[model samples]
Target: MPASPSAKIRANVPIPLSEKAIATRFVSFSGLNDDKEHIAIIYGSPEQQEAPLIRIHSECLTGDVFGSQRCDCGEQLHEAQRIMSAEGGVLLYLRQEGRGIGLYNKLDAYALQDTGVDTYTANEMLGFAHDQRDFTPAIDMLKALGLKRIRLLSNNPHKADDLVKAGIEVTERVQTGVYVNQYNAEYLKAKVDQQDHSITLKQN
Candidate 1:
């Protein structure tokens, strides 16, 4: 059986505070239904009538926290903050590790990937879907914040689809791209090929 909605855990965690010269406001909350800790950096004036730009990024402890280069999570996050700070929007950092498979299993999948398996194949071997995350909590949180619509920042079409389906009007999709290095080339390809993520690689 699928896990119950309440089985998901949530916690309030502080992000490493930033002192950069950007207009940013930090907020943290937990998703009780999904049990995910969430941190947000709100940029721009919330009173602006324009549709707020938002990014619902799932937590990647290895990549975001540990500076692992096997994937572009950390880079994408930094890019999100940079853009949002400049343009005005919100960065919703969701704590769904490994696309909701949790930490230990994600590490296990990493070991499998190191042995020549791609990310999709590794997740399958570990009895998981290619992406097990759901965006319902994001929708709820946006509503709670009184955001009626947003220009979403993402390369994944499904994120737009999911938010729209959940009644959050997505006005536009803002692309977030990063350079592909030797460490994350295969991983990025797996995202494009297997997950059908719409990522544009930086041209040499």
Candidate 2:
């Protein structure tokens, strides 16, 4: 078990919220050939090397940062943060943007999607997997944090499966919030239909 990670660590003092105050720590994974530098954000410290809440959030520039309603990424990210804030856990913000197809490639897929296509097929049309993301970075971060078990937070069943496959014990699976908007209703439905996401939306 790694007590301390070899990655660069920086402390963000006094991360204040409307209802609470917490400390945020950013751990930068070193020596990556990928153009994007990935990091792990620890919300609240866990008591010991035990199973804690973890959200392996892939980067979503449009939805997460810009609050785009084209998908539910922003809503899910915020919901995961709020939950982990109260319960205590780590959020591994992976740099696997656009499901590991890069940002511009994702943007191109978005254009294809606008042409009456779904999310999954759009990626295929671009010669990529439905989700090209790999959870190895997340597994490494958890191991570095001295955690072998986790209560994974996600609606995508494949996330937990991937963690388990990476030799981490998923003690519990927490379903993050689902935000259904006019712009992303079809997208959400397509996820449930094709991606096997466990999202419960109001049926029409």
How would you encode candidate 2's per-residue C-alpha lDDT over 37-59 as one tens digit per residue? 66777777853537888888999
Report each candidate's C-alpha RMSD, comma-separated, in the order given: 4.0, 3.5
TM-score of each: 0.85, 0.87
Worst 10 residues of 2 by lDDT: 1-10
lDDT value, residue 200 of candidate 1? 66
Per-residue C-alpha lDDT of model 1 across residues 1-204, encoded as one tens digit per residue = 122333222332334335663466666544345555566666766548478889999999998888898888998988887776567787878878998899999999999999999988999999999888877777766765668688998988899998887778899998887558898888888888876788766655
Candidate 2: residue 134 Cα off by (Å): 0.9
Model 1, residue pairs in steric clash? 8-34, 8-35, 9-35, 9-36, 10-35
> Which residues of candidate 2, in runs, are more than 4 Å off?
1-19, 31-36, 47-49
Q: Give the TM-score of candidate 2.
A: 0.87
